[model samples]
Each structure stands twice: as structure tokens, then as C-alpha cells.
Target: MLTAERDELMRIIRQLSYEQREVTLASGRKSDFYFDGKQTTLHPRGALLVGKAFYAALRQFPAPVQGVGGLTLGADPIATATALVSALEGQPLPAFIIRKEPKGHGTGQWLEGRKNVPPGSRVVIVEDVVTTGGSSMKAIERAREEGLEVLGVITLVDRQEGGAEFFAANDMPFVAIFTKAEVVG
Candidate 1:
């Protein structure tokens, strides 16, 4: 069962992120509304609520996940918040970051937090929003490349676009804290 924090996060998203304006999404699709989840994910109260809500939701996955992570920029704060909350709860889920491209210097790798989560660790990809699931998919691909097992995906919000179907088509388990309609409708 979800807690009130989930509802609070929705309220924050609606107030700060959701906007009924014509916008083009990262997926190149035109949308009637835009939800730049960073607006809330970066807020103090919003971050707290996200951590609490996502931790509660993460507990529902049948397969245990040792770490949380996803593509950078958007997923960065979500993963970090969840990881921090999990640690405070005494479970300590490590967080990883998947870069859009391999770093140019040093090891030139694609994923960060590698030491915290060695190969074969079970992890769930976390995202701020899900549109086409393309970004999360890339993260999953990179995770697999690093020998990590992807248990599933958790998103702050689902645009109710093709993301769920995209994940389902790829046989990936997915859960969203809020849907587009739930936040703005």
C-alpha cells in the first residue's frame, strides 16, 4: 500500500512540473502537456516525498534489487534520493548513473557507482518520467553490459504514452508513482 507521501509528490508535480502547453518531448513527439519532473525532483520537500514514496513502491517488487539507477540528468536525483532513503531505512540501496556516452577520460566507462554495485548486482532503473521508455531502455542495456541484472523500472510519473507498452513489449516490469491523468486531470 502506498503512503500519503505519494499523493504529496503528485501535488508537487502538478504544481511545479505539469504544464498544459504544446511541447516536444525528448522522444521527438509533440505533447499537449509537459512534465519536466526536475522541477519537483530538485525541490527540498519534493525530494523528501519522492524518496519516501519510491522506497515504499520499491518494496513491492517481487525480485529484490540491490541497487537503483538510470540514465543521467533526469534520473540522477531520483536514484540518489531513493538510495539515501533506503540507507536511512537501514537497507542501503546503492545508486548508479548511466551516462549518455562513455566518459572521455579515465576509464571511459558508461556507468558510475560501479564500485558500490559490482557486476551481477540486481538493480532497478529509476526515472523522473516515462514517455517512450527509450532513456530507461538505454540504461538497462548499459546495466546489462556491466553484468548487472535489471529487475525492473520505477518512474516518478508515466506520461501514459507508449512507455508502459514499450516496457511491456520488451518484457520489462514497470511501475509508476503517478500517471499523467492522475496528476493533471
Candidate 2:
């Protein structure tokens, strides 16, 4: 269920991040418009709204969700926000950070914050934006390698550029809070 706060988050995203200009995405695709989700996700109010909304969304999963996370840099803030909000809501959701590659030193881990989560735990992967789904896919793969069961994926924005299709093709559940059309139009 969408709330006024979530709607306001969308509005903030459009106002702060969405832009009408040719841009190249991480997927190496060129588009007439772009959404730099970090701009909004990192903001104080935006983070609070995202945390509340994402926590609400995660609660809708048919199965229990023990944690939330995704690839770092983009997913970092979302994961932290969700976890913090979940804690405040009396349902603690630990956040994990999946590295693009394992660290070169100090335990050389691929996943940071793994200690908070146990093996075989159910987790929902998150992303700020979904394009080709490469980053999300990598995070899922890494989670599976660590014995985590990926229940579903959530993204702040879906570009309508094959990401949803990719998850469907791979038999993974996916949800997006907003879409490019919803924000840009």
C-alpha cells in the first residue's frame, strides 16, 4: 500500500534526480532521460521515506525476510535506511553490502555486515534503480554463494528497460516503488 510519504518520496526523486537529457546508464545504454537515485536516497527526508516505504514493501513478502541489502555504492544507503527503520519499527532487518569483488585485505570478504546475518537466512535484495539488472544479479549471486536465500528484489525506480523482464526470466520476484514513466511523465 502506497502512503503519502511514499508519494512524497517519488515527488522528491523527480524533483531532485530525474532529468531530461541524453545520458549513458551503467548498462551502457543511452537514454533521453535519467534518474540519479542517489541524489534523493541520500537526502534526509528522502532516506526516511524510503526506509519506511521499503520496510512496508518488504513486509508484503510471502515469506519471512531476515535481512535487506544489495550491491554497494547505490544500495548502501537504501540498505542502511531500511535496516534502521526496521529496527525502529520493532522488526530489525539487518543490512548487508555486497562488494563488486572481494576485498583485498582484512578477512577479504565479498559481503560486509555478514556477521549480522546467518547462513540460509532469507533476504530481500534492494537497488536504487534497475536497468539491465546486472548489479542486482551480482548481489543475488553473491548472496546465494554465502548461503542466503534471496526471497525477492526491490528497487526504487525501474527504468522499464528489461530489468523486470530479466528478473522474471531468471525466476526471481521483483518489485519497484516507482518507474521512469511515473517519475518523468
Candidate 3:
């Protein structure tokens, strides 16, 4: 059965509208579809639903995550919202942001927000959407390099297109609030 939180999540996602047409994805591929996850993920109600759903999803894991974060731009709001709601719920999961490239000057850090987690600290990576899984995987790599024990990945939308399978083949647990068909159809 869908919980109240999940139902709310669906309601918010279903309310999003989009135009159908060929467009290039971040992965640089042409397709007859496109999704602006930010439209839903950044909306007031959408943010609340995403935050609550993310928290609930994390509960299914074996260990508590020390933090939740992801690549910049796309993943920023989702991470922040999750962190905020987690705190309100008293669980207080911290959030972090991963830069696409290291800053050129002053500290030259790649990951921002909070300090580097202690080695083996469990962390969950968030993404607004997963197409080829490149950005999410890159975040995972950076997290691992920073000594984080990546628990898995959570995304607002999964484009299908082998993203889930790719993560699974590599032993990364992947979960999403909605799939391409769920949103597009």
C-alpha cells in the first residue's frame, strides 16, 4: 500500500506538465523526450513530497546514512530539502554538494558543505534525474574518494534506458520516486 507520504509524492509528480519533443540530454544524446525534473522537484509541494519520500526511502537501508548530497545545480535543492526535513523529523541528516570540477582557487575543494566525512561514514547520493547515470556515478566516485561509504543512490526520476540496470550491475542500489513512463505517460 502506498503511504500518505508516497501518495503525496505521486500527486505532486502527476501535477507536473511538459511538452513532448526531441531534445538533447545532459549525456549528449538525442531523444524524442525530455524531463525537467526541477519543475516538480523544486516546487513547494513537490519539494516537501520529495523530501519526505527520500527520508522514508532511506529507512529501508541497513544502516543510517551520515549525510545525503549530490552533484551541483540539479541535485542541490533536493539535497537541501531532504536535509531540512530530516532535521525537522529529528533525524538530522547533513547535506553536501559536489562540484563538477575542483575550484580553481582558495581551498580548491571539489565537495562543498560540511567537512569531509570520516572514513566509512555511510552516505546516500541524490540526483534530480538519472539518464545515463554519468553524473550520479561521478558523484559516487567523488564520495568514495572522500572516504564516504556510499550506501546507494536516490533520484527523483529514472529515465529507464538502462540506468537502473547499470547501477545494479555495478552493485549500487538505485531507487527513484518515478520512472520516465510514470511521468511522461
Preferred candidate (lDDT higher): 1 or 3: 1
- How would you encode candidate 1's per-residue C-alpha lDDT over 81-122 as one tens digit per residue? 999899999998999999999999999999999998999899
Which ten-residue region of model 1 has the weakest summed lDDT?
A: 1-10
Report the lDDT tens digits of candidate 2 across residue range 48-106.
99898889889668768999999988999999999999999898889999999899988
Candidate 1's error at 161, in angstroms? 0.8
Tens-digit lDDT track of model 3 for 1-185: 14776666666665663447789888899888666778877888888878887887788667768889999988888888889889999988888998999999998988887563566779999998899898899999998998788989999888898889889989999998778787656
Give TM-scores for every candidate, taking all chains together and pairing residue i with residue i.
0.95, 0.96, 0.91
| Residue-level error in angstroms, candidate 2, position 40 | 0.7
Residue 157 Cα positional deviation in candidate 2, in Å, after optimal superposition: 0.3
Cα error, residue 17 of model 2, in Å, equals 1.1
Best by lDDT: 2
User: What TM-score does prediction 2 earn?
Assistant: 0.96
- List ranges where model 1 is wrong by over 4 Å: none
